[model samples]
Target: MQIYNEFELIARLTHGLTTRPDVALGVGDDCALLDIGSDSQLLATCDSQVEGVHFTLRTSTPEQIGRKALAVNLSDIAAMGGVPRFALISLVIPPRFSQEALEGIYRGLRQEAERHQVAIVGGNIAGAGQGKQLMLDITLLGTVRRGQAITRGGAQIGDVLCVTGSLGDSAAGLFTLLHPDGTGAENALTFVQARHRTPVPRVAEGRVLSAFGPAVVTAMLDISDGLSGDLQHLCERSGVGARVFAEHLPLTEEMQAIAARVGKDPLDWALHGGEDYELLFTLRPEKAREVIEAVQAQTGTRITRIGEIIPSGMCLIAPSGTEQPLQVRSWDHLH
Candidate 1:
């Protein structure tokens, strides 16, 4: 039997699942949107981090692991333009895991929850049995105005493509961790590693974008799977295509320095390095300047206009004014 990739398997499994009218949006978005009896809609999303796969003690402390586990889920809620309310944490504990480390993880989780004003309502704990890795599965609940949730399917042709914050820092950080030669500048190494360990969820930015409403904002999703791959997701959902300007991509000085030291193309990392946890969104071409200025002023996060939505076919416009196919080389857990 042929095994499917992460997305192909998701489509195959979720096909024709039963749903009700209350399910405003399901199965194909950053969060599951449901209309409860209120002026707001409920937003739910779940994500997990596994030892060795998502993190390692050698690279990240237990607290960092716990924080990142929740941070990833928070990013999902942010993508939907919602206010996170509660979280339920489930843990798969490997045998003999140190109590001190576990407490540190919980401390980190509490710190993040307090930062976002989200309560840790409840959860379940289970043994890993024969498994040797620790895992954390978190279900986050948030709420948005009755009709204000943003989605990836709302982008239209001629919409401006924008991204929040700089890109490729997390990937560059992971590179430094995996291939540490102790030769890079101390500040650069620290900056990238911190980005990889605990990324800031764009909750404030999402709220500001949502206030603009869908007609103006159009579409959004967090860049957990790389810019090119997630842009492909947005294009597919919106039934349109995109043209990304390679020269316009935002790269941080630290990331560029690390890439230079390693003799790797920073552009490749900007395009395909996953786990930046930044918001990639589309907006009306005419409203681009307004939205960009508002988000910057309100949230203090830099927003870059990298391209525009097209009628069909994804392409990259190079610095030399050459056009080429924009390929998706993002991370895939199931690969």
Candidate 2:
């Protein structure tokens, strides 16, 4: 049997992935060089998805796992209003895993890469020996016009906090997958499952939000850490507080149904269920409506005004017209 070395594996894995014009050097190089032009700023981010921790092979296919691993990183770039240009992937292949399965994973990665016009520049691959798990780590490079990249620190005190798309579906989907019987309807199960497995990064929406005048989108970040927790991040960075109205939260009917069957609060899922990958942005109070309408008309993404930045700290306004300090009970890797 001929043993494949790391170089050969890298060649096979990155085959056919094309780089953008800005990329001076792609694969087969010691380091990837990018020519992000004087008018553009470079954006870089890295993310990892691990077996048993992020997903289980029993519940998710290799392709789904591969797409999500890259999607999460893409969400990071999108949060900055940047265009993803290149990627460096690292794979920890476990024993008994076939080359076909590995290739399928790359195919999944390629699908998202192509959709976003990103390329696989380079990466490292290694075997995990035995009794180990598969892991994928991706570092993505992106570019945005100078002075247009958004951050989490520009929100004003009265800026309205808005979110793209519905929330908690990913978390509810996870629950549905774990507790299948809890999903009374097969359609509900499928919807949530797809949401959990193949989350769409809001790249176009982020770019649109950032394209508006500086006063339009004051602050922004992706909601990978859940709405409640990620909102606090924006608040901390901008040195302001916020109040998220429970009534205004956008929850899908599917999320509601799954929550009811599982005896879980759908609101809680929306608040702290993390990994939604939706954009959480703060907008100028006066022009909020115009920007929202423009985004809806252009991209068809549902934007909801969920809260507003305040003087200090975070709170949640209940449906009964009372306010309580919003807890920071988001996803923590260390527990």
Candidate 3:
């Protein structure tokens, strides 16, 4: 058998899978959309965090791990322009796992759930036979008004591409963890590490964008697989291309300082680093300013127009006025 990357494996597994008519959208977008005889469409998404694969107790506390495990799924709901309402958490516990740590993890989960106003209605716990690592699998359910879910398939040519918050902070935070000897300003290190541990899902911003409707917002997704890789997803689904202005990518001074201290390119992290949990979206060129202003005023999230939808070919325009193919060098779980 040949090994496949994460996306290739997903494409292979989801090919020709049977789905019901109630499935409003399926298999490609951030969340599965379903119409269960309600005025609102349901958004469903699930994500899992495996010990050693997604996180380690050595780096992240049990609370942080639990919070992040849920936060990632919340981001998927946000990407779909839905309001998260409920969650089901499944746990795979290894032998000798600390009970106190589990309680701490639940505390974090509760904190995040309260913040998002999502109810944890039910879940399952299972023993991991012969497994040494703990894992949390979460299924999140959300809703959006009928005909209002923002998906990746609705972008149009000349639409403005936008992203919420600064990119690369999570990546920089991970760098500090992996290479602790790399020194930077204390505040910068603290900020980036917090970003890595507990990412803020753009739920409020997503709601604001969804309120604008897909006609104006065009398309949206959360950046989990880096800007370039996730942008590829958006383009493929929308059957459009994009041109990203390298100079326009939002980067924080903290991430830049950390990158400099670690002797890495901040641009690389901003473009290709994964797990930012920020919203990546497109809007009609004419309505871009209005949407940006609305989101900022309503949610206090800065939305930056870093690119535009093009007829074909994804490209990156450098600050020096040079254009080149935008490469996807994002994290691949199965690679």
Candidate 4:
């Protein structure tokens, strides 16, 4: 469904779910309610997962889909250097799907929520008609102390660009599922599948970055789309461009193995293959190692300084030393 059919119902029913005294005004209202704290800042982010678009029933379990639905949004919150505290879920399912599948989805959501110490404040559910696709939508609400939140627009030229975890694994994993010739690369495929099914948000890394200081973050973004696309966002938001040294990209052995077997460009997969759910961010030169080390120790995720933010003319300078304007060629729903 296009969401138009139930738009009115969604609006009409939201008000009765609960009334928060802190909410100045909510639902059917021009804006959401909130009693902004003098010392705290609020953050909100939403993500949507569709059956065929984001995942297919062929390779995904209900729990995997469910966990992914929430993890992706939580990753946004983490990118902002905020602690996710609550969530609102909206699930659309076909009538014929088993109750067990639905519950498994919830189980997955709950598993991530518990792991992240977040509470499911509220949500809505609905049934899709026959032949309709399934979808999961979630809005995660988080909070951070005032002046502590990071943003995409703060990246500065000369700032070192970093990623919290290895790249291309998620993309490689998707490849494995699509082409099972790599099945015997047992360890490799499993790693990729896990990355696809349940990505680890760099929440702790975000927090550690916050403690080190402010404006230390010149720019910040999460890599849900692909590396190339997400860098576009950071560059666009910060009004600056970048150069990713392809050789410097931290690739997992599994990713390399898969890429070699398929004759796929590992660097292309690293640069454009999406859904890594890792953080692509930039920080001041002086604080790079300190913050990278801090975040790695705390998050147990490798933090690689792959390149530097630069002026607009050279969007991305590859390791082969070729310069080309970067494009957002990754996942865009309407595409």
Q: For each candidate, what TM-score against the reference? A: 0.99, 0.88, 0.99, 0.87
Tens-digit lDDT track of model 4 for 17-39: 87666653344211132457667
Alpha-carbon local distance difference test for all models: 0.94, 0.85, 0.93, 0.79
Quote the lDDT for 85 in model 1. Answer: 94
Worst 10 residues of 2 by lDDT: 24-33
Which stretches of model 2 miss by more than 4 angstroms?
Answer: 1-37
Query: What's the ranking of the predictions by lDDT, best on top?
Result: 1, 3, 2, 4
Candidate number with greatest lDDT: 1
Q: Runs in model 3 with CA error above 4 Å? A: none
Q: What tens-digit string does per-residue lDDT give for candidate 1 at 118-145?
A: 9999999999999999999999999999
Q: Write the per-residue lDDT of candidate 3 for residues 1-335, one digit (tens) a residue.
A: 89998888999999999988888899989999999798899999999899998998888998998899899999999998899999999999999799999998899899899999999999999999999998899999999988889999999999999999999999999989988885698899999999999999999999999998999999999999899999999999999999999999999999999888878999999999999999999999888888999999998888899999999989999999999999999988887
lDDT of candidate 2 over 1-335, digit per residue (tens): 56555445667889999779876445532124356678876777787788898988777887888889999998988888878889999999898788887887898899989999999999999888885788899999888777777787789989999999999999998887787664758888888889999999999998888798456899888988788778877887788999899999999998899899878999999999998999999999999999999889989999999998899989999999999999977876544
- Model 4 misplaced regions, further than 4 Å: 1-35, 182-184
User: By the lDDT metric, which is better: model 1 or model 4?
Assistant: 1
Superposed by TM-score, candidate 3 places the C-alpha of residue 60 at a distance from the truth, in angstroms, of 1.1
